[model samples]
Target chain A: MRSHPHHHPAPDLLLAYAAGSLNEGASLLVATHLALCPHCRAEVTRLEEIGGALLEGTEQVAVGDDLLAGVLARLDEPARPLIRMPDVTPRPPPAGMPLLPQPLRSYIGGDLDRVRWRLTIPGLHEAAVPCRGGSVKMMRIRAGMGMPRHTHNGDELTLVLAGGFSDADGHYLRGDFAATDPSIDHRPVADADGDCICIAFTDAPLRLTGRFLRWLNPILRT
Target chain B: MADTTEVDRLNGLLLCVARQRDRQAFVALFNHFAPRLKSFLLRGGMDAGAAEETIQDVMVTVWRRAGDFDPSLAAASTWIFAIARNRRIDRLRRDRRPAFDPDDPALVPDPVDGAMEMMLVEERAALLHRAIRELPAEQAELLRMAYFEDKAHSAIAQERHLPLGTVKSRLRLALARLRKAMSGDTLGEQA
Candidate 1:
C-alpha cells in the first residue's frame, strides 16, 4: 500500500522488461523503479504471464540426440538449486533511508555518502555507476536549476529518487519513471524545493541542443 | 493449444514432484518442457549443443526447486517458465557491474492467488491464444519474435525494417489488449 509515483513508466518500456530484452543499464533503472511501484510490478508480472501463455501456443521443436538421456543421467546428481528471485535481494532499506532504493543499496554497498559525485556544471553533479550495456549515472540537481534544452543520441530512462523535476511534458516526483528516445526534445528543470536526485540510463550519450551548451555535449559524457 | 485436461495433468505432475521425489513425474515434466525449452534457446540463435546444455540445466533446476511450487500463486507453466527465463538470463549475463537481476528477492512478480481464482494453465492459455489470434498480424508477429525468439526490440526493428518506436508502440497496444483480457476487464464488461 505504499504511495506510487504519479508518472509511470511507458507500457512499452515495461513490456521490454517483461520480455527480458532490455539491456542491463535500462533494466537496472526499470528494476529500481519497480521496487518502489507496486502497480508497475503487477504489470510486469502480468506481461510475464502473457509471455508464458504465448509460449504455450508455440510449436514444439525436437530436441537434439541424447537430450533425454543426458537429463536422466543427471537425475541423481543435481547442481545447487537455483536461488529464487526474492531470496537473495534484501528488501525495505531499514526505516529512515528514504533516498536509497533497494537496487541502489546493493550497488553502493549501503553507504550513500561514499558516492563520488563529479561536478559537471554549477549546481549539477553526475555520479556514474558501473553497469553493463550502457552508461548509467546518478544525477543531482539543485533546486530551481534547469538543464540545457536537449535531445538524445539514444534512449534515456530516468527514475527520480527524491525531490522533483519537470520538462515540457510533465512533472516527475519520487519513484517516477521517465523515458525518452532519440526523437524527443526536452529541457528538464528542477522543482523549487530541495535538490533532486535521479538515476539516468542512456544507450548513447545525451546531445545538448542549446546554442551555447551544444558545444558542451561532447564533454558532458551524459 | 493447452486443453484443460492437459493442463490438469501437467499440474498434477508438478504437484507430485513437489510432494515426492517422483522420478517418473520428473520425467513427465522433462518430456513436456525440455523440447520447447531447447527450441526456445536455439531460436534465440544459441548453438544446438549449448541449447541442449541450457535445457538440461533448466530441467535439473526445476526438479531441485519443485518443492517451492505453490499452485495458488502460479500455474505450473508459469513457474516452469519463470525458472527457464531466469536460467536463460544467467547464460546471457555479460560484464560484472550487475545491471539488474529480475531474480532479486523483493521484486517478486504478482502471483495470482486464491485457489478459486486460479486456473493455472487452461484458462490463461485459452484466453491468451484467443488474444494472440485477435491481435493485428504485425503486432502478433512482433510479439512472437519478442516473447519466443527473445529478440531485442532493436533487432526486431532491424529485421522487419521498421522504426523502433513503431515496434514498441505496437507491442504496447498488443500487451494492453491482452492484459485487459487476462484481468477479465474485457469489452464484455461494459455490457
Candidate 2:
C-alpha cells in the first residue's frame, strides 16, 4: 500500500475548493487530495456547511407559482442516470493496473498503465492531463533522477501519486500536496527506492533556471 | 428560529421523500429551499429565467438523490447547497468542478469514532451558523463575494482594489476565526 500524505493543501486553497471558486486544474488537485486525506475531507465538509448556511441565509424570493408545479410535473419523468457516488466497500483497481484514485482516474481515462508517456529528458516521462485555464500533467521520474531547478510564475500544485520526492521544503509521499508559487525555487529529486510519479497543476508555465535545461522551457509549456 | 430542531426537521422531510416517495414532504422541502435558492442564484448574477431553470434541475436531483442523504454525514441544507453549487458551476460554464467519489477505496477512513465525530459536526454546524451571522461586516462581505460572486481571489483583489495578499489573509482570518469558534465549544465540553 502507498504511504499516507504528510503535507496538505493550504487553507486558502481548501476554502476556494469548498466555495467552488477554484479553476478546473486546481479543483481537480484538491479533489484528489481530499480523496487521500480524511482530515482535509472533514475540514472541507465543515467548510461546505458554511456554504449551506450562506445558502440558507439568503433572502427568500417568492418563486413564480408555476415553477413548483413545473418541477413537480417532471418528478414523474424517468430519472436521468446520475454518476452517483460509488458503493461503500473498497473496489480493487482493474487487474494489473496501478491503484489510482477517482476524479483523477476518470480524468486520466485509466490507471498508470494507460498513460502514454513522452520522454521529456533522459529519465523524465510526462503525459498531459487535459484541463482548462491551467495545465495538469502526470510526471514519472526515474529513481534518483532530479528535475531541473525551477520557479513558478503563477501558482503550481503537486500531489504525490506514488513513490516519493524531496526538495528544500520536505519529502512528499503518496497523497502529499505541495502548493508552490514564484517565491519558491527548488529542484525535486525522485526517491532512490523507486520511480516517483506525481500529478502537477500549474496555472502558468514554470521558469526553468538550470544552465542546461533553460532552453528546454518551451517544451515544458502547457 | 432555524435551530437544531429546524435542521432535524429538514433532514426528516428529505428522508420522507426518499423512503415513502412522499410528495407532501417533497413539497415542504422544495417550498423552504426553492425561494432561497432563487435569491442565491440571482445574487450570484444568474438571470431570473436561468435561476428558475437551474432550481428546477437542482430540486429534481434532490428528489432523485434523497435516498443518499445521511444526516449523520451531512446536514440537509449542506447537501442541498452542494447540489446548487455544482449546478451553478455547470450553468455558468465556470470551470468543471472536479469531485472525489466519497466511497473510493484510496480514501483514508476518518480516524475518529463515527458517533463522536457526528456529534462534533452537529455541534460545529450550530456554532458555524451563529459565527457567520455575527462576523464583522467586512469579513461577511468577503464571504459573500467569494460565494455569491464566485470570483477567484485574484479577481476579488482586482475588483476590491485590495492587494492579493490582503484578500487571501482576510479570508484566511475569517475562516480561522469561525473554526476556532466551533472548536472552542468542543474543547470546553471536553474540559
Candidate 3:
C-alpha cells in the first residue's frame, strides 16, 4: 500500500480500527488509509484475529433460552425512523475555496448555504454541518482561536480544513489529522492568527470543564 | 463454542435490526455491550451516572449507524469496542480530561516484559487473550498489570512493594518470554 507519509492514523485509532469502533466518516478515512498503508492494515488484521481469539476465550454470558426468539421478535416488530442514514456526500466549500481532501469532499456535496452559523469563540465559530445521520456539526477555529484545551467521552477525529494547530505531539495543518487515544491527555491550541476549520464527528454531547463553564456548555450546544 | 456461534448469529441479527431501524435490536445491542462499555469507562475513571449516560449515547449511535458495519473487516464485538473507545475519548476531550501517554518512559512497555502482556492477552475481549492464557500464572499476572492497567515498571514495583531493579528484571524477562510465545517458541525449549 502507498503511504501518504504526511498522514498517519493515531495509535489509538489503529487499536480502534483493530477493534472496529470508528464511526463512518472517520472509519472511511482510516479505511482509505488502510487501503494505502499495508503495514497499518496488517496490524489491523492481526488485531482482529487477536480480538477474535480473546472473544473465544471469554466465559460465555448465559442468555435466556428465549434470547434468539426475543431478538427475532424484536426484528419482526415494526421499524422506526429514529435512525436515518445520511446521504454520504460532501458539502461545498465557500466560494473560491481550494479543493478539499477526498474524505472531506465526500461529505460536502456542493452545499454551503444551509450550514447554520452557531457561535464563535475567540478564534473559532461552531456551525451545524447538516446531515441525515443524526446531529453532526462543523467547527471552524480561526487561525488563532483553534480550540481550548479539552478531552472527550468517545472517539473524535478532528480533520483540518485550512490552517493548523499544535499540541504536544507537533503541528497539525490542513489535511493533517489527530486521533486521541482514550488514555492519553492533550492540549491543542490553534494557530497564532489564521483559522483552522475542523469537521468534528461525535456520537455524544461535549462535556465542558468547571462549574461555570459546564453550565455554559448547554448554551453553546447548537 | 455454541455460544460463540450464537453470538455471531446474534450479531448478524443485530446488523439486520440496525439496518431496518429496529428499536428492540438497538436496545438489545445496547443492553449487551452497555455494561461492558461502562466498565471500560469506569476503569478509565468516570463516575457511575456519567458512565451510564455514555453507554446510552453510544447505543444511540449503534441504533443510528447499524448500516455502517462491514462484516468483512471486523466482528460485532470488535466494532462495538471501537465505537466505545472513540466515544470515551471524545467525551474526555470535551471535558478537558487529561490523556495518558503510552510513550512516557514511565509508560513504556518493557521489551522483555511478557508476564503482564501475557495475562492481558488472556483477558476476554482482548484480541490476544488466548495467546496469553497459555502462559504460567506468574508471567500472566505481571503482563496483566503492565498492559491492561497501563502501569509503568515503577508503578508495578510500588504496587508489589518490590525493589525497582527486581521489577525491571521481571518485566524484561516477561517481555522476552512474550516475544518467544508470540513467535510460537516454548519457554522450555528456550531454557
Candidate 4:
C-alpha cells in the first residue's frame, strides 16, 4: 500500500503492459510508476498469472525437434554472459537526483546532473537516450518556463521525472504520466517552485503549430 | 483442483532444478513449457525458427536462473510465462523488430509479491483457469488474441472488423469479470 500518483495510466494501457505490448518509453514510465504504486503492480501480477494459466492449459503443439540437445550443448560449451539483463542490485542515483526512480537509474546511468543535457532553447533543454523502438528524450524546463502550443502527429507519452508541470489539463507531479494523441493540443508550463524534468517519447514527430518555434522542432527530439 | 497432481509436479520440477540443477528436472520443465512458450511467441507474431530459437534460449535461461525461482511466490507456469515474456522482449531488441519496445507501462521485475495471500497457490491458479474457461466464447476468443496473439486491442478490432470502442469495452468487461473471480474485487481503482 504505497501512496500512488493521483492519476494512473488507463486500464487498457495497463493490460498492454501486462501483455508486454506497450512501447518502451511508456513502459519505462509505467515501470517507474508501478514501483511507486503497489496496487497496480498487484493487478499486473494477477493478469500475468492469468496469462500463465492460459499458457498452461493451451494446446501443447510441441516443437518438431528436440531443443534440449542444443541447449545442453551450449551449457557444455562455456558460461557466457546473457544478452544483457542488468544485475538485480542497481547502483544508487548520484547526489541531487534522489527523485529519479528505479530502472531509469539503470538506463540513464544516473540522475539529472549526471546526464549530459543539451539546450534546445532558452530554459528548455533535452537529451536523447539510446533506445530501440521510439525517440526517448529527457526534457528539462526551468522554473516558470513554458512551451509553444503544439499537437502531436502520433502518440506522445511524457512522464514527469522531477518537479511539476501544468498544462491545459492540470498540474502533473513526479511519477505522473501524460499521454497525448494526435487530436489533442495544449501548451505546458513548468511550475514556479523548481525545474520540471520529464522523460518523453513519441512514435512520430510532433506537429508544432506556432511557426517561430517550428524551426526549433529539429532540436525537440519528441 | 482437477490438475492438483500436475500442479505439484510442476512445482517439484522447479524445486529440483533450483536445488540440484537436476537435468531430469530441466527435461520435464522444457518438455512442458517449451512447446507452450513457442505457441505464445508464435501468437506474438514470430516465425517458427525465431520461436524455436527463443524457447531454447528461454529453457537455457531457466536452467541458469532457476535459483531465482521461488515457488512460494507464484505458480511454475506464472514464472515461466514471465521468463518467456522477458525472452521475447530480448529477441525483439536484438532483432530490431517493430514490436520489441521494452518501454511499456508494465512494471519490470514484477516479482509477484507474496503479500497478497490470494488464497493457496493451486486454488488461486484454479480460480484463474476456471474464470478464463467461463468467459463468453466471443470474449474468450478476444482474450486469446490479446494475450496469446500479442495483438493490441486496436489490432484485434481491425483484424476482426469490429469497432475499436466495442473491442475496448468488451475487453474491459472481460478483465473486470476475471478480476472479480480471482481476487474478490475488480482490482486497481481510480483515485
Candidate 5:
C-alpha cells in the first residue's frame, strides 16, 4: 500500500462511483484510485450512507412468501466469493513499487511481467485492457519520451501507476489521477528519471492534435 | 429519520448471525431487509421476478458475508444497500463493477487508524440519513433519480430541461448541507 495520493477523481466522478452509476472502465479507474487515496474512500463511504438511507426510505414491497425459504434452503450450499478472483498468476510483481494496484492488477490478469505490451511508437508501448462500455489501455513511456499532442474526443481519465508524467496541466506521480477532456489538448512527457506506466480510460478514441500526427489520426484511431 | 434503536437492533442481529451463524438471526434480517431490497431493485427497473431473485441472492450474501460487516464502519442498512447495488449492477449491466480487493498488497490503508475513524463514520451515517431526509424536496428527488434510476447527472439535466451545471450545483449544494449538518454535532463535541 502506498501513501495518500495527491491527485484525486473529481467530485462528480467520485459521487457517481459512490452511487454505482459509473460504467466499468470509469469505475475501474476510480476503484484503483480509491485504493491509494483514503480521503476519496471516506467520501465514497459517506455517499454510500446516502444510498443506504434511500434504500431504507423507499417504499417496501414485501418479497414473495417463498423467497426467504428459498434463500434459507440454499444457505449451506457453496457460494461464490464477493470479490471475483480474476485469472491472475501467483507470481509477485517486479521488485520495488507495484505498478498496477489490486483490482487493476487482477484486471490486467497479473503483474507487469504478464502484460503483453505492443509498441505504439519508438519509446512508447501500449496494451488494451478488456473492459466494456468504453476503452481502457495501459501505456508505458520510456524516460523523457513524449506522447504526440492529443485531445480526448470524450473524457479520458489516467491513473499513474509508476514513475511520473507531466503535461500542460501538471506533473502526475504514482497514484496521481489526471482527467482530460476535449477542452484540453497537450502532449505529455515521461519524467526523465524512469519509465512511466499509466492506465487510461477513454470514452472515445483520442484525436491526435499534433501538427504532424493530425494527418495520421484517421489511420491510428487511438 | 432513522431511529437509532432500530438501527442498533439490526446491527445486533447481523452480529449474531456473524458470530454464531444463527439461523434465527439470519431469518429476522432476511425478513426486514428483503422487502426493502426488493423495493430498491424494482425502483431501479428490475422486473418483479428478477427483483425477487436478486433479493434472495442478496439475502444469501448477507448471510454469508455477515462476518465482514463492521458496525463501526457502517450501519446495517448502508452495508446491505451497497451489496444490493453491486448485485443490481451485475444483474442489469453487461459490464463488471470493479471493486477494490481489501486483501491486495497494493491496496492503501486508511490514513487514520481503524477504530476511532470507523466509529466517526458510523455516526456520520446516521447524520447523513437525517440530512438526506431534510434536503429540499427537489434536491432529494434529484438524489433519488441519480441513485435509484442509475441515471447520470447529464441525463437528469436533460430530463429536467435544466443546465447540467445547474443540476450539478444543486446536488453539490445538497451534499454540502449534509456535511455541514453532520459536522455541526461533531464540532460541538470536540469544542
Candidate 6:
C-alpha cells in the first residue's frame, strides 16, 4: 500500500461514513480507506450498527391520507436505462505499465466500449459510471499533464487508481485516497511518464483559477 | 413514544419509500428531520430564513438521494445531521471569499434562540440515551460536554481542571465504553 505521512481520514468523514451521509462516489472513496484502515473500519461498522439500531427503534407518525397513493403512483414509473456515452480509449499501456488496481478494474474495465468519457481537459478526462445509488465517475490524467490550479467549493475526495500525482502535500499513488477540505488549494501534477486515474466526488463545482481557463469554469461540471 | 422495534421496522418501510419513491416515507422523513436540521444550521450562525432554506434543500436532497442511505451504516437522524452539516459548510465556504458588510441588515440578523423539540420518532434514541446514562458518571459527563456544549478538548480540560492528555485519554476511553455498551458488549476491560 502506498503511504503518505499525513494521510489520515478526518473524524468527520468517518462519522459521515458511519452515518451514510456521503454520496455514492464519496462513499466508495471512504470504503476504500476503511478497507485499508481496519481500526477506522471497525469504528465505522460499530457506528453504523448503532445507527441501524437507533433507526429501528424510531416511532412512526401518522401519515397524511394521500401520501401512500402518491408513492404508489411514482413506484409504477418505469426505470430509466443506463445512458451510454461516446467512448475514448487511452493509448494501450506502454509495453510494461503496471496493471490497474483491482478496485478500479470494475470501473475502468477491460473493454473501452464499457467506459464513458465525459469531458477532456488538457491532462484529464472524466466519465460517469452507473452504480447502485447514483452515477459515479473517474477522471484520468495523462502523465506529465497536471490539472490546472483550482480550489474546491466544497469537500472533494479523490482516490488514485493508477500511476501517481504529487501536490504541495505529498505523493499519492494507487490505492491512496486523499480528502481535501475547502481551505486547501493546490495543483496536482501527474507523474512524468505514467498516467494517473482517480475517482472523485464534489457537491459544488470546482473553481479553476488558471488565467486562460477561468472562463471555462461555467462549463466544467465536477 | 416510538418503540425501538417499531423504528427498525420503519427502515424497511423507508427502504420501500426510498426505492419505490414512496412520497409518504419522504414526507415522514422530512417532517422528522427538517426542523432539527434547521436548528442545527441556526447554531452555525445562519439566519432563520437561510436555515429554513437550507433545510428545504437538505430534505430535497434526502428525497433524491435516499437510495444512497445504507441502513447498515447509520441511523436516520445521524445521517440527516451529516447532510445538514455538509450543506452548511458548503454555504459558509461559498461566502468566505466575499467581504462581510456589517451594515447590511440582512447579513447581521440575530441568531435564532429556539431549541428544536426532541420528539424523537425513533425509539432507539431512548435506548441510546439510556445507554449513555448508564455509563460511568465521568465518562457520561465528558460525552455530554463534547456533544452538548460543543467544546474542544483543551477547553473541556481547562474547565474540568484536568491535564490536557488526561482529558483526551478520558474522552477516548469514554467513547470506547459507550461503544461497547451500545453494542451490547459487557465491559470486559477498561482502556
TM-scores for every candidate against the unseen true structure: 0.87, 0.92, 0.41, 0.84, 0.91, 0.45
Best to worst by TM-score, what's the order?
2, 5, 1, 4, 6, 3
lDDT of 2 at A188: 96
lDDT of 6: 0.55
Q: Candidates 4 and 6: which is better by lDDT?
A: 4
Off by over 4 Å in 2: A1-3, A82-93, B112-123, B184-191
**Consecutive 10-residue window with the lowest summed lDDT within model 6 chain B:** B95-104
Runs of candidate 1 with Cα error greater than 4 angstroms are A78-98, B93-122, B185-191
Expressed as tens digits, the lDDT of each residue in B37-71 for candidate 3 is 65566654577767666665566566556787765
DockQ of each: 0.41, 0.62, 0.07, 0.36, 0.66, 0.05
The candidates, ranked best first by DockQ, are 5, 2, 1, 4, 3, 6
Best by DockQ: 5
Where does candidate 6 stray beyond 4 Å? A1-8, A35-39, A52-113, A130-135, B1-131, B134-191
Worst 10 residues of 3 chain A by lDDT: A97-106
- Clash totals in order: 2, 0, 65, 6, 0, 11
Candidate 2 DockQ score? 0.62
lDDT of 2 at A142: 97
Name the TM-score of candidate 2: 0.92
For residues B1-191, what per-residue lDDT tens digits would candidate 5 score against the true structure? 46667778888999999999999999999888888888788878899999998888888889899999998778899899999888888888845788887766777777555442424544666666777777899998888888887777888899999998888888888877776755545436456
Q: How many backbone clashes does candidate 6 have?
A: 11
Residue A197 C-alpha lDDT in model 6: 76
Q: lDDT per model, in order? A: 0.75, 0.84, 0.51, 0.75, 0.83, 0.55
True-vs-predicted CA distance for residue B78, candidate 6, Å:
15
User: Model 4 — TM-score against the truth?
Assistant: 0.84
The better candidate by TM-score, 5 or 6, is 5
**Residue B42 shift from truth in candidate 1, angstroms:** 1.4
Fnat for each predicted structure, in order: 0.39, 0.73, 0.05, 0.43, 0.73, 0.04
Better of 2 and 6 by lDDT: 2
Where does candidate 3 stray beyond 4 Å?
A: A1-36, A48-222, B1-7, B95-129, B135-191
TM-scores of chain A across the candidates, in order, are 0.87, 0.90, 0.56, 0.84, 0.88, 0.65
For model 2, the TM-score of its B chain against the native B chain is: 0.88
